[model samples]
Target: MSSINGKTIWVTGASSGIGKSLALKLSSYQCNLILSSRNKEELLKVKELCGGSNTISILPLDLTNHHQMEEIAEKAISKFGSVDMLVNNAGISQRSLIIETKVEVYEQLMQINYLGTVALSKAILPHFIANKSGHYVTVTSLMGKFGSPYRSGYCGAKHALHGFFDVMRMEHEKDGVKVTLVCPGFVQTNVAKNALTADGSPQKDDDVATQNGITPELAAKKMISAIEKGKFEVYIGGKEVKGIYLKRFFPKLLHKVVLKSHVR
Candidate 1:
């Protein structure tokens, strides 16, 4: 049996993509799930698809509203008595060049993708500390490890997560809290379609790389394995994941390649 069996897991962004896939995957493990997203109706649909009315509860949430995160955390914990794990998967993406992107766009990405995750994690810290056993799984991106063209704001936000979560892991290690940063290169999802453009409007179109990416279900399985093994970080996706390694081992070479690729 999986170590996740019977655990109470709260998954944000459960309406679609990796979050939805992870919810469905965890359902088969017999875990109690509290699924959250801004769209209540979509959350219900995902819950129904999971086929476990008794084990799944829907909680509509907007990560951008950081002020309410503490209350949301309480509600999540109340649902299953205590939340044993939190999957901080709710986030937005950007598809604009740094110079073309507005300042507000940067703030929007930081608020939703970085600050929101941090706020929620802080809200849950007390619970995790009291229990002395809890896990935090955050879905970052390969961009978090290195920058890419047209994703300057997205890269900044994701990079911020690495710094924040790393400190969290270090300080909370003695409290028996586990933190796993899952960096995905690209998985077939609406992320590109929903990405913010230079004018703060949705791109409304998918990227070629995203269209050819792996299925969200496959990514979820790998994430679960990383979580079970208590990995501090994991990279998922196609050859794009190799960029992370190249950046670490051959910075000058990767720099030239990134500029030449003209990604986006």
Candidate 2:
């Protein structure tokens, strides 16, 4: 394994799910960690679970507040003088149908999933350029690569991330700034349960495919492996990972298969 001892890492959405798992696993590596989310209480809990070591600090953040990203990034850099890597894992899920979903739902999805991520990344870009090296590991879904029945808005936002990050990689390669897009197919998390519904309220329900998917720990492991290897992109999960290849080579077939499966 690549050594990260003494390096500083920053992770968003670290209060729960894959982010939380990554924090727990990274704690063993003896690296400085900065955890961010909208929930300070849960972040503190996660820090304690990671042995409450002095290497970890919690910084609460709400992605929807795009204007504050620059300031937050400044504070994050102050944590350990410099951050070697950043894991962009904070995002929301959607479960509403295209026709039934409200316009506000789409707007909210873009604000958080696409624009918010972009803002924070840009806030940290200058630092990476000045340092001559940094890594951005963003967790977008397989839905970012293809469309699904109930995730119209979600797919749109995720797709936007790919477009922006691809260009970032191209423009910043000379600066030693690396980008890794993590496309997770599914994982047993609260994503499905907390997905926004047609009226913009939480689904408060579970999805079969998501419930039976890999554990968050396993997903976190795969994500970190991709980051360590500096992979441009990595897909994780069960059979759903094939959707990426299918969409690339057989668009029509992927469409048929998706409709037939009724995934939600």
* lDDT of candidate 1 over 1-264, digit per residue (tens): 789988999999999999999999998887899999999999999999999578899989898889998999999988989999999999999898888889999999999999999999999999999999899999999999999899999999999999999999999999999999999988999999999999999999998889999999999999999999999999999988889889999998898998997678
Whole-model alpha-carbon lDDT for candidate 1: 0.94
Summing lDDT over every window of 10 consecutive residues in candidate 2, give the lowest-scoring window. 1-10
Off by over 4 Å in 2: none
CA displacement after TM-score superposition, residue 94 of candidate 2 (Å): 0.4
lDDT of 1 at 262: 64
Alpha-carbon error at 164 in model 2, in Å? 0.6
Q: Weakest 10 consecutive residues, lDDT, candidate 1? A: 255-264
Q: Model 2, range 1-264, lDDT digits (tens) per residue? A: 465677799999999999999999999996999999999999999999999988999989999999999999999999889988889999999998888999999999999999999999999999999999989999999999998999999999999999999999999999999999999988999999989999999999999999999999999999878887889999999999899999999999999999999787
